[model samples]
Target: MKPRILLVDDEENILKQLRWALEPDYEILIAQDEYEAKRIFEIMGPAVVTIDLSLTPGNSQDLSGLRLLEYFLTQAPSTRIIVITGSSDEASSLQAVRLGAFDYYSKPIRLDELKVMIKRAFHIHQLHQRIQQSYPGSAEGFHGMIGKSKSMQEIFRFIERIAASDVSVLIAGENGTGKKLVAHAIHNLSQRKDNPFAAVNCGASPEHSLESELFGHERGAFFGAYAQKRGKLELAHTGTLFLDEISKLTPALQVKMLRFLKNRKIERVGGTQTIDLDVRIIAATNHDLLENNVFDKDLYYRLKLVPLPPLRERKEDIIPLAHYFVKKLCRGRRSPPIMLSPEAEGALLMHPWAGNIRELENLISRAVVLSSHSVLKPSDLGFALNSIPTDVNLKFAKKAIEADFIKKALSKNNGIVSRAAKDLGISRVNLYELMDRYNIQIQEFKISRSSERQQMKTGEVL
Candidate 1:
């Protein structure tokens, strides 16, 4: 089907011109007033929208367009929006972009240039869709998980293979490695993409509230249950329910979960009727299911297809994942995507990534805020690079050279301390303590070559 574009303008001449320019290329939705625009918005839900800056009482002002922009963006965050403004409306145009408009066209609009702007808007929308659909699971996949490690790719493959199935999935990862995205991907790929993919963080919600949120409540289900309300499970019927920190489930809740897993049914709080569902279930945890032995064996078996390896082991995928997040999180914002300079990328590579992908994402976001140049610098990322070849001071030259020497020795040893120490003409014990002192991750000291080429072919990244 042809993508739809809702064209909102009070002037008949401008609407006619746009319709003439774009109707052949798109399905045009024309709205002459705010009321008409809203009506079209509710019904058509166009893929993109174009609104003029002047559509009020005098039909020649900026405020009307700004208000409409806010309403449209609020209504549909993913929809591409383009604003039209007069030559004098430079501040309004930038305001539009800040308000989340994709781009603004200065009027009297040039037809061919306007076409390019419209095309770019569509391009942004398509890229967003791709990111949402095929995000590889892991912290790296979220805001960029750390390490381009082989183990991470294996996890990616595992997620891809299982995303097509309706079987319950269990994701096991370290605390900060982003197990939730894996759960999300599975939900998105399953047969219920259109339905709500409701998620509840088991560890975050209190026991009482968790129960109420999961199964909902009747008017008198609990002390605060003033009115009957639908639970996450009910809202997620025919879709997917993602439970995070699954290991945190209390013993009583575990029994409830196991029953639902086996029976495909739930009873609302204080309600007697059993509700059968086709909702798919995905569970995630920071704890090792096999190690804790607290997870119900039956439920664990039902959920487990196996766990994804941690980010520290996935060295090969780190850079690509970082690039993916840099594009997603920074681009087209008040501060657009800042390029990672060679030093910045190297600094990122050198870190142990203790918090894994989540940590990296936070760093990148912070860097975007701090960076002065178009290219993000190491200092912008808040890391004191031992390998800093270019600090403002020449006084640190000796320290930099020593850091380089230590790094070279570690590399020659293939992460074997004894061998690296021998190569450096130092004691293995000394080297071990030195590496720790410098915060070097011996296991990930080197970058992975021959990157994983396969893009996630499974569920979308939403």
Candidate 2:
């Protein structure tokens, strides 16, 4: 079917002329008044609409056309509306655009120029539809996290499978990758969801207090202990205890934790009574547990590891996640749904998200709050325009492209050097050599498979 276009103008002659020009390329729907335009818009759901701002016949006193434009946009934001205004009415034309009109034409009606605008509007509409369809759970989110990348989808599946299990889970990722969110997801999906989910940041407090924080202290246990207090472990009984920055745990705390896991019991700081509790442990760290000797080897072995890759490794999810954050942050605000312009989207995709999901969420939230325009442009995002190179040197470009390809291959094949090498039509040895040259670690890709096995063993999935 030809794309639908709605033309709204007070003059019959102008509407007829536009219909004649657009009929061949589009299914033309003409509306001479506000009522007719709205009726057609509601019934047809046209992809593009052209409205004359001076809709009240000869008076031109009423701004019904602009009101109608706002209504159509609020009702169906995906539909692109182009405003038609006299050359002198620049202010109204600008206002129409600000009210979410796709574009505006100064009328002495250039049929060709109007046609080009309509075609572009239809193109943008189609692109928007495609983006909406491709991004799964973009609005609803998955386990309090927003991403539609293959790696994230895998993570969602793993979470579903392991959430009900009683085993200890160790989530490893960068500082802003939402490790705590993952811990929440696991608890929320588990049988112990109704129970309290206690979280403790091991790095947030002093070493002396860290032990008492994890394990309860009796009355008069310390100078500050006026009354008996339950620590995170005790409070999280019959629930999940999220231990953030577990890598920061002091040696004394680590020994206490290891003992608790081994014995399924904990002793209060000043009391000899051994307390038996059923608590699930979910630990998170931004450090590499195997490479870093900072974490206890025995404790690490006791927990099932779930590694979250950095955002740069999952470039495909950037735009969708940004849109998700925009919708999330803009909720309850007076403005309409904020949109990302093409340039803004490009900037989001091109920039290396060092802080990962947390960084992206913050950037988008700030943009939504600060930007006055309905559409969020690159300037609104506060990214330095020079951050992404405009002029690419051939040698650097070639190497960059090669590195991206290698990373993608490794990611797609689950970071197995042999599989990635075969997929890239190279030997495993050659792949290893290239990876070494590029400073790529094979271990980054291995987490998916290992997590999958852990999920399966825990009956997270069939």
Candidate 3:
């Protein structure tokens, strides 16, 4: 059976035209006014709806259509609503979108364009359903990490499985990808849950200070050591110690850390007495420590790795995560309920999310603080139609490298797709995909080859 769609418009001709065009694809339900539309919507629960903004026939000011749109959304936030308005009524159309309509189409709606918009709405609705169905628990997310993708599900399961063990664990991911959160979750679920969880940023302080922070210094040990101090490892005692940015640890500190990991003992700076501690180690890094050769191999091998996926790779989680952030931020501010406009959601989906979950939370927080409207549009989240990359150097470098490799391979192969694919060790299909992704014109490469050949021939003739 075809998917159901509700069409609410006062004009009989418009309804008939849409039914004729869409009947083949969707189970068409037509409503001539708000009352009929609401009745059908309540009964049928269609996945998509197209409603005219002015539903009171001659009264152009009547906003029953907007009210109906709001009602449908309130009933089912996942419902895709496409608002239709007169070509001159742009203000009403914008207002309808701001009220959480999926999209807006103006008068003189060509059947083809309207059909395309309806198709996109259904697609987005299906995605929302898939995310909700796949996500197991409430919107609070898995141990504070919000993700609906299969990768995240696996990560959650992995955390649960390893939380009972006492082995050293390493959580690895790009910066702002919530490595520290995972570390905390591991500790919270472990047997040492009642004990204090101590956290230290290896990269946040100078080398001497970081060493002193991790392994306490006795009085008179250093210039600022006015009193005997307990370090993170010592303070944690029977609990977990989260070492963030562990790759930044200096070689001297790494040696001391490895020794402690092996023997579960530590010596304070300028102190002879050795301290026996039973702290579980949970280290996190944004870089590949082993691959970079900056971290100690013995220490790296001791910890079990838990690699977290970046936000861009988990598109299914974007909307849910955004909503979660909005709710959290609004509740903190004692603000009323705020909804993300479909336009804003689309913008978020399109973004590359260089800064991952942290970036997303910050954007939503900014929007909630600054925007007075109950609904957030793309502009409210600092995202334009053409969104820019967040200020993350690593993501930019990776993109640049990938594009350069493709261009070099194409140049070496004289614009031949097969040869370039072989050079890049990828399929021709993949090469073409990459070329399209980077907006690299094959015609430019092919034309350059032709021009070079022509130049050679002209020189020979001369």
Instruction: Please give each candidate's TM-score.
Output: 0.59, 0.59, 0.55
Query: Which regions of candidate 2 deviate over 4 angstroms?
Result: 1-138, 391-406, 410-462
Estimate, for each residue in 1-462, the C-alpha lDDT of model 1 and write its tens digit.
566788998889989989999988888889998887875675355768998877763545438778888898766678898988878878878989988998888888889999988988888888986876576554335323333444555566666567776778877778667787677656556556545577788999888889988988889988888999888888777778888888888878888989998898989889998889877888888776657577778787777554665554454455566676677666536455568776676666556777888888788777766666788767778877665545523234334434556776665455667877887788988887877777778876543443212122112231
Query: Measured by TM-score, how close is model 1 to the native structure?
Result: 0.59
The sequence of per-residue lDDT tens digits that candidate 3 reaches over residues 1-462 is 578899998888888899999999998888987887876675456899999888876788797988999899876667899998888998888888877889999988899999999999999988976776465476757766787766688788888878887788888899798897798778867888646577888989999988888999999998989999878888788888888889888999999999999999999987999999999999998897878587788888788888887887666678889899899777657689999986677677767889999999889998999999999887888876455444323354456557767776786567899999998899999988999999998866665656788545322310
Stretches of candidate 1 off by over 4 Å are: 1-77, 80-94, 102-149, 325-330, 334-338, 374-377, 385-462
What is the model-wide C-alpha lDDT for candidate 1? Answer: 0.72
Candidate 2, residue 420: Cα displacement in angstroms equals 5.9
Candidate ranking under lDDT, highest first, comes to 3, 2, 1
- Model 3 has an lDDT value of 0.82
Q: Report the Cα lDDT for candidate 2.
A: 0.81
Query: In model 3, where do residues sit more than 4 Å from their true spots?
Result: 1-136, 386-462
Q: Candidate 3 versus the native: TM-score?
A: 0.55
